[model samples]
Target chain A: MKKNYSNEDLHSEQGATISGQQQKAIVCNGLTKQFGSFRAVDNISFDVNEGEIFGFLGANGAGKTTAMRILCGLSYPTSGEATVAGFDVYKQQERIKKNIGYMSQKFSLYDNLTLLENIEFYGGVYGVSRSEIKIRSSDLISTLGLQKEAHKLVSELPLGWKQKLAFSVAIFHRPKIVFLDEPTGGVDPVTRRQFWDMIYEAAANGITVFVTTHYMDEAEYCNRISVMVDGRVEALDTPANLKKQYKTNSMNDVFYELARGAKRADN
Target chain B: MNSVEVINIVKTYGEVKAVKNVSFEVAKGELFGLIGPDGAGKTSLFRVLTTLLLADSGTATVEGFDVVKDYREIRNRVGYMPGRFSLYQDLTVEENLSFFATVFGTTIRENYDLIKDIYEQIAPFNSRRAGKLSGGMKQKLALCCALIHKPDVLFLDEPTTGVDVVSRREFWEMLNKLKKQGITIVVSTPYMDEASLCDRIALIQDGTVMSINSPDRIVKNFPKTLFAAKANNIYKLLQDLRRNSEMESCYAFGEYIHFTVKADDADIVRISQIAERENHDGLEVKQVIPGIEDCFIRLTLDSGQKIMDRKK
Candidate 1:
């Protein structure tokens, strides 16, 4: 597949295609996760289109993490029908894990390992052939312009470089979907832009991008966004449509409007 | 008198210079910010002023006491909240608060008014273990503990990092209330939007200070006229704009591409014309005022260029 599709092609395709006919990368129907009495995820329903850049947003304690864990097949939902990459999240969790990549700000790469070594390790863990790992790792390193520093310890690289490298490694095995949780936190503005560019490239190549971020600007970059409030998806739509519906000019305002009334102690 | 002062501070770890000749001062009762991303020396500087880590060279003072000579006095008069949650995770919220107060040789009752606003929010979880609290509650508890003694100055390192937007806004509001109580606040954050909330901010990056001024002045001082251009295909528009010889810089800003031109008299028409030549669909261009993030980017790039020039 050619990775040369422009943003126009992506947007036009999204509007032209009937979403019902398109392949669903993720489908959550009445997904509920109950921890004793409290419902962390309260019967949420949504569908993510294949290759779509889906933004999952919520305030603290809004159940975004809990719902994401359920969809990622890490934790089972209490009552729901969901499928990730055409595999049931409940019964086929192992298969779902095999088809997905996950990265979070707190845990992404190994500080002790060198760049190439980390890639080789992850590639091996994902069951990629050693020969293929060698070829792809080199290509990844050169593409990120890290050929000179590829042998240096991951800890020695700047935070921005580490994040970008971590992202590349996460998607290395050619997973069908990638889950990114606050991937650009603490990165500078310039590097943050570069990171989004990498995300765009990934989406163009047909990898479904499921990301969560606190940065409102990043929320605007997604093809569609779902805002969780008090364990319920209060709003879900394209950025432009959300802004229009909320009678606001920015996504920040739209979020504030929906989230300010949240009764959850913002825990 | 200034609440905090630093002169020619330099900290290093082996080959890496964590802080290089950094200097800044925070006025009494002022909300001053050290705005920078991670690894930009904000934490190192915070550690030096809070008397946790000694700088390799140069001196700093907190609450009019020398960090080196009168570390005890400074430690007693200033509260420091490290970037990480430093309270005992196993302890309940109330236990953590009382523990911090006792360590400061003060009672929570003595400073109830100082922390009442923040503490009340977490009071419901008073018996819950610190580790059990959610992210927002943890932050509030940390703030309460830091203020339990009613210190003259407060140093918060990345209090809002990784926090959601709503919680971040609420945290800033709490800071504003604290400022009104005449507490000198010296906080650091990686978010540029938060810079505007501070009375003045020092934009730091890569072990150096880029600029220090009021957020308004910093935005006003942007050297180039910025234009925000949007099209149906923002990625293609970005690529096309980058290729234009007249464009100085082009980067995605939300739904639009913010760019500056090499020409001094660049206008909206010229920007639109350039985008039109690229055959962009639904193209729109407008002159927009620069924000603190824009200024920070410009300063960082200029400083980076200077370093390159020196290397040559």
Candidate 2:
């Protein structure tokens, strides 16, 4: 069963609606994105709770990134409405940007800038105070074991270190929510585990996390995950529930089952 | 004759010890996995085995040839796909495959049967540049190139990573098929679930092996009466449960909280009433079987993280 929220709690957040508030961390209705004849993200709807670690999952081109772009205000929905963090994605994208931190799967840290400079530049772009950026940047740099590398160009750092530092910068703003599109793609398991720990720490401090990954095991990490196929959220709920519902021991099986089902339906 | 064998291999960079005294073996036609999280020396181990880097110490042999002394021969005979996408970006799909095959002194036509299934999927885009292919297609092309030489052993380092999920599944499916072809596959991944897909896995942490066994046996060996419980304000319930003296370790597992208690304690029945007292509605608690993640958690706790249960 999905977590049922009270109408009052749903509407408690500022400028939020009760119908969409129950699943308010993210609310998308009839969301669709099309590139000419191809529907990148088909019409879909789902609600993410106030502080849920919602997993936006799919195979490559399964519309996972496309859906994320729409929700993140990076790309517009073809014919639907989406409100991210209670701000309309289309009009209040700036507000949404301020309230959410994003780490693209290709979270490319500039090779030319030192760790500190990259952090400073991003912080400056976000209109953060110079003093605040410096303080948080150093603390984050140290936490990620990049103190020595802070003075070195990001290109000089290893891939593992680059990934960790990227994560620190993404959430440096302490946004209400953070979006990670395959943030741990090539990271080692230990580092990925550490990354998940950081995600948990952020969640504990009341930050919602939205992530997309191909690894089914990582699906087990999200509090709730939605599997997109052919542009619709075919399955949604906790990993356990979805696994049990599909009678599959793993999310991989669930994905195959739904994908096959979708194909059969299409034919 | 062992297909792959190593003794006390050590690799390091500067003051940091990337790999320390690591050794393992892979039998001919066997699918072996070097399972570890990032920084667990997986990449270093792969690099050493593939002969891309020399070990500071220790010795290794593949197909009866020494990894160091016969490094060039080994390079030509083994397939190596690094974690990151490494291919000629300017080359087209067909060109990339042909180039790799030619590099190994072979032709794609000679090994056409080997990569036919995979290549066919992207053949329509044979003229598409390697840089232009989708993540999944790029993965297929890379695999095709790696297999073009029909190597005796295959080394894939997080091959499915960065690809879409559907493609990831397809890739694993392809690997399974290759295993049937008598290819000795040595793959590494930080993903625990993928670890299970291998014939046998070595769970490495901090440059040490935690366990080496089949996935089923490993989960079966988990020694804990794991239970999943959750209620209204589930996170709060987890915190409250951890404070309880009966609980041993309480972790948030997806929608529910996975917990363990002292084995002898029959006070497990107290969860519902406690939830009621905490003003939690419909507290659902049930005993659950352990999975790979569960095994990992217990392993972490065993190594001394001190996970506690909720108190009354």
Give every candidate's TM-score on chain A: 0.92, 0.87
lDDT of 2 by residue, A105-143 (tens): 475578899889889988777666677787788777766
Model 1 TM-score (2 dp): 0.93
Model 2 lDDT tens row, B118-193: 9998898899888987777788888998899999999998786555545666788999889999999998876666
**Global local distance difference test of model 2:** 0.75
Judge candidate 1 at residue A239 and give its lDDT: 95
User: Mind giving the per-residue lDDT tens digits that candidate 1 earns over A113-168?
Assistant: 99999999998887777777888899898888888888999998888889999999
Docking class of 2: acceptable
lDDT of every predicted structure (CA atoms): 0.87, 0.75
lDDT of 1: 0.87
Runs of candidate 1 exceeding 4 Å displacement = A1-21, A265-267, B305-312
Cα-based TM-score, every candidate = 0.93, 0.79
lDDT (C-alpha) at residue B209 in model 1: 93
